[model samples]
Target: MNDDEKTRDYNKAVAAFAKRYLPYKQPLLKTIENFSPELADVVIRHGLYEIWEEMTPLLSYRDKEIATLAALITDNTVMKEITAHTENCLIQGMSKKEVLEILTVLTLYIGVPKIINVMDAVKQAFENYDQHIKNKG
Candidate 1:
């Protein structure tokens, strides 16, 4: 395919993928775009097009959310992302028990103190999910 066609196809694929799997992020992306348009483009193109699109087909969506949540839990930075992915874990069909279990597993590797921080982030996610999404339906 020509360069223009390739770009078009890539964008189309990103749109479809983001719509289904990444809708939780649209508000965050829009907020970032409002302050930094170029960074927003890079986040969208790199994350959706390059990262998620490539990785998602290799795992079920639920598995992908688990993996992402685990990574965010371990990194111990990016509190907001940790919260977002924790919520996404539920949106992807994980029960609250399953989500909490991730913390139990991570405690073995990350130690109790760090896991404490992760626990609070997860608590916020759970509260948000319960209040906003879980009982609505």
Candidate 2:
């Protein structure tokens, strides 16, 4: 493929992947549009599509998202983001028990104090997720 063709294909793949992952949350989309359209595009295109597509074969999406959540929980700087990712992991077909297992294992490396603090957030995420499923049903 020529340079132009390559760029076009990449853009197309990115947009498709973004739609799959982020879909259309109007408020969040609006915030991304208003504040950081470029960053948002990169996240949708490069971050989700390109990067994740490459890594997904090595580790499934659920595993990767769970690992990311554990890391974020350990760092304790991005609890909200972690919550979102945990939710995404669920949407992508990870079981709540599996997610909890990942967190349980993470406590070994991340220490008890951090896990203790973040466990509530994780549980709340699961509870909200269950409620959402019930409402959908």
Candidate 3:
């Protein structure tokens, strides 16, 4: 495809993926809309569609989710973002026990202090998952 065609395809795929996977909250979307159109475009087009889509083939969704969780735990990332990703991990087929184990292992590498917040996030995710299951049933 030509450059224009490729860009169009990427845009479409990105929008669809964001709607499904990385949907921004309305306030966040509005902020992006006003201040950083290019960043918003890259997140949708490149981060979700291009990067994540390309990586999905190489790693199982669960595996990628676990890896992402591990990295975020180690790096002491934004708690809310980490919690959201943990929820995504569960939604993508990771078990709560599995997530806990991954976080436990991360403690060895990143130290215990860094893992405290991750543990709390994982606990919240598990509670939410359980609530979701109960609601479904």
> Could you estimate the TM-score for every candidate?
0.78, 0.74, 0.76
Off-target runs (Cα >4 Å) in candidate 1 are: 1-25
Candidate 1 lDDT over residue span 1-137, tens digit each: 57686567457645745544435555665586688866755666556565666655878767877888888778899898888888878878899999888888888998888888877888988888787664566
Winning candidate number (TM-score):
1
Candidate 3: stretches off by over 4 Å? 1-31
- Model 2 residue runs over 4 Å out of place are 1-26
Model number with the top lDDT: 1
Cα lDDT listed for each candidate: 0.74, 0.68, 0.69
Looking at model 1, the pairs that clash are none
lDDT of 1: 0.74
Over 2-50, each residue of candidate 2 has an lDDT whose tens digit, in order, gives 7575457456655544433333232564466468867765665466656
lDDT of 1 at 36: 88
Q: Which has the higher lDDT value, candidate number 1 or candidate number 2?
A: 1
The CA lDDT at 12 in model 3 is 71
